[model samples]
Every structure is written in structure tokens, then in C-alpha cells.
Target: MTSLVRSIWGEPEERKLLFKIDFFVLSFVCLQYFSNYLDRANLTNAYVSGMKEALGMTGHDFNNVNSMFTVGYTIAQIPQNLLLQVIPARILFPVNTLIWGCLTMVTAAATHVRHLYVIRFFQGMAEASTFVGAHYIMGSWYKDSELGTRGAIFSSSAQIATIFSGVLQGFIQVPLAVFIVSWLQRPSTKNLDQLHGIAGFRWLFIICGLITVPIAIYGFIFFPDTPETTTAKYFTEEVGLAFILFCVP
Candidate 1:
């Protein structure tokens, strides 16, 4: 078994190093991407579920809100990528994640369309670091022969999240819908206030935002940046040196 594993994955020492990198680096980035997509997709779910009527939004308002997010994402992409050269990924990635998480939570409180426009725009700016930045970090760690698979895995997280957002919304909506219908048939207005009048869409944003913050905290503590500059204890100097040497032509 050991010989077969070595034949496919290289010697034991290199295999151990690769495992560490995948655990600390790839796992965090994939989870971050997953959370990012969850936040992004929740808006559409919210809009359809009840946000449109609650906020009194009309045609083109939704489109414009999306445009605001796109504008912020596009404007920040170049600058954010450039910053990766100077700022450490550990600092940059986590900070960006934290910012977006807060913005997502703030979306739950939006009383007007204008509030969504502003919050989504800034959310896009914060999320601009994720997709491309994950690729950049993966390239820093994985060899050319190993990168393609890792990149594919990273990209797939977004698709999984897109599917998951719909499923999660469905799970939240079904039971609540039943309860609301039953409550409406009741004679008493008593305990109706206990529901706090929070819309289903609002809960979607709140849940997604809550899911994002811990990912940022994980990145801050475990993301290894580049092998050259990593501070992760598991990625010792010897392993870093060997990894760098292996990458040299």
C-alpha cells in the first residue's frame, strides 16, 4: 500500500507536505468560496421569497441593484489582485471575508431599495478578492502538475453553494409557510408579535451572514499565504524550503 501510494503521489515526505498544504490552504479557500456564493445567491432567493413586496420594489429596481454589485466587483478586482503582491494573503483574505460577512448581515436590515443598493455594492467589493485570490494562492502552493485538479476543486465549491442556497431556502420556507398559514386562521392576534415580523428573505441574509464570519476567522488563523512567507506552524521552515526547491525549474 505504501509503495503504491508513493508511486502515485511521490515520496512520503513530499506527500505529507502536500497533505498539509491541502488541509490548511485549499480547504479554507474552498470553504471561503462556498460562503461567498451562498451570500451572493441569497439575494435572489430573498427577492423572490418576499423582499420585492416588503420593500415595494418594482421592475428594473432589482436589475439596478445587481448592476451596483457588479460595478463594485469590477472596479475592485484589479486593485485587490495587485494588493496581493504586497499584503499577505492571511491578512487580506480574512479581512475581505469579514467585510462581506458584515455587509451580508446588514442586508437583513435594509428598509429601502437604496439600502440594498449600497450594501450589495460594498459586498461586491469585499468579495472581489475570493475567486481570483484563491487561484493565486493555489498557484503559490501547488506545482504545475498538481494545480489543475486543485483549481477545479476550488471552482466547484461555487456551484455546490448555488445549489445549496436554494435547498436551504426551501427548508426554511416550507415549515414557516405552514406555520404562517395556520396562524392566520386563528381567532387571536395574541403571540403574533412574537414572530417579530421578520420576513423569510431577511432570515436568509441573516443566516448566510452568520455562516460567513467564522470562515474569516479560520482563514486568519490557518491560511498559509505563500510557502515563502507562511507563518503556519505546521508548515515549518524545512518543509517550506523543500517545497520551494521542488518548484524551481
Candidate 2:
């Protein structure tokens, strides 16, 4: 069993390097992607939870808003990839994430469906690089044999976050309901909508933004650029040079 595992994972030194890469690269990207998925999916929650009625959204308003986001995503995807060639992943990924988080926070202030359209468009543009950029960074650090496992982990983080977003919404709603009851109550009003005139949709965006912005900060501090360009404290010059030599055909 030990020999079989070693055969599958390479020698001890390779395994150590793999472990470091997983810790530095996969872990940070997983966290960033988790926040990205949460922010992306929370729009649906916002729509159903209170945004539609608050903004007087009707007809195909939801579809149109989604379409606006898709347009931004499509427009930015190629450009974002091109930009990544010139910018370091550590700088590019975190900066985009921070911008997206700010956009998500701005989403909480949306007063109309048009506001949503604008915010979602830019939000989508900000997030356009996350998935593709992470994949590109993963490829830079991982060998072909290691990519399958790391890729699976990176991809699944988003799915797990989708489920967590619902739970996060639930948690946000609890505090929001309390706040509404305590501060928004009127003599003639029995519910938040009657007193505050809006559902708690705004809070959802704010909380998601808060979650995202901190992770972006963390990413800037810890995210490994690429093996070739990384400044990770553990992966010294000798290790990086050795790895480069090992990869040459």
C-alpha cells in the first residue's frame, strides 16, 4: 500500500512540493472562488427575497438583468485573459476580486432595476477573470498528473459555496428581521415591508461583499503568483530553479 501510494504520488520530495502547492495555491484559489460563487448566486436570492417587489420589477426584468451581467462577462473574458499575461496573478486576481466586492456592496444601495442592471454588469466584469484566471494559475503551478485532483478541488469549491450562499442568506435574514422589528416598526405596520418599504435583499449583497473583500485581502498577502514568479517564503530560489530545470523537456 505504501509503495503503491508513493508510485502514484511520486517521491517524497515531489509529494512535499505538491503539498506546498496545494496549501498555497489551491487553498487560496478555493477560498477566492468560494466567495466569487457566493456573490454570483446571491443575486438570485436577492431577486426572490425582496428585490423584485421593491424595485417594481415585472415582465422579463429578471432575465434582462441576468442578460446584462452575461453581456459584461462575455465582453470582459478575453480582455481579462489578455491582461493576465501582463499582470501578475497575485496582483490581478486580488484587485479584480476587490473591485467585484465593492461592486457587490454597491448592489445593496440599488434603488431601481436599472441600478441592478448597471451593478450586475460591472460586477460580472469584475468577476470575469476569477474562474479562468484560477485555472490558468493552477496550470502554471501544477504538473499534468497533479492537475486533475487540484482542478477537482478548485471546481467543487464553487459548488459547495452555492449551497452555503443559501445558508448565509438564511443567517443574514435572521439578523435583518431582528433589526427590522426593533427599529423599523410603525404603529400601523406589522412587517418589514410595511414599515421599511423594502425586503432584506440589500443586506444580502452587503454581507456577501464583506465576505468577499476580506478574502481578497488575504489573497493579496498569501496567494502564490506562479512557480516561475512566486515570492513564497517557503519556495526559495533554489527550489524554483530546480523545479524549472526539472520541467524542461
lDDT of 1 by residue, 1-249 (tens): 334433454477777888998899999999999999998899898888888988999999999999999999999999999999999999999999999988998998899999999998998899998999899899888889999999999999999999988876775576443453454434433322213576778867877888899999999988888877887787675454565456444
TM-score of each: 0.87, 0.84
Best of the candidates, lDDT:
1
Error at 104, model 2, angstroms? 0.7
lDDT of 2 by residue, 77-175 (tens): 999989988999999989988998899989888888999899889888888988898999999888788899889999999999899888766655664
Give candidate 2 regions above 4 Å deviation.
1-10, 175-199
Q: Candidate 1: which stretches are off by over 4 Å?
A: 1-10, 176-194, 247-249
lDDT of each: 0.83, 0.80
Backbone clashes, candidate 1: 0
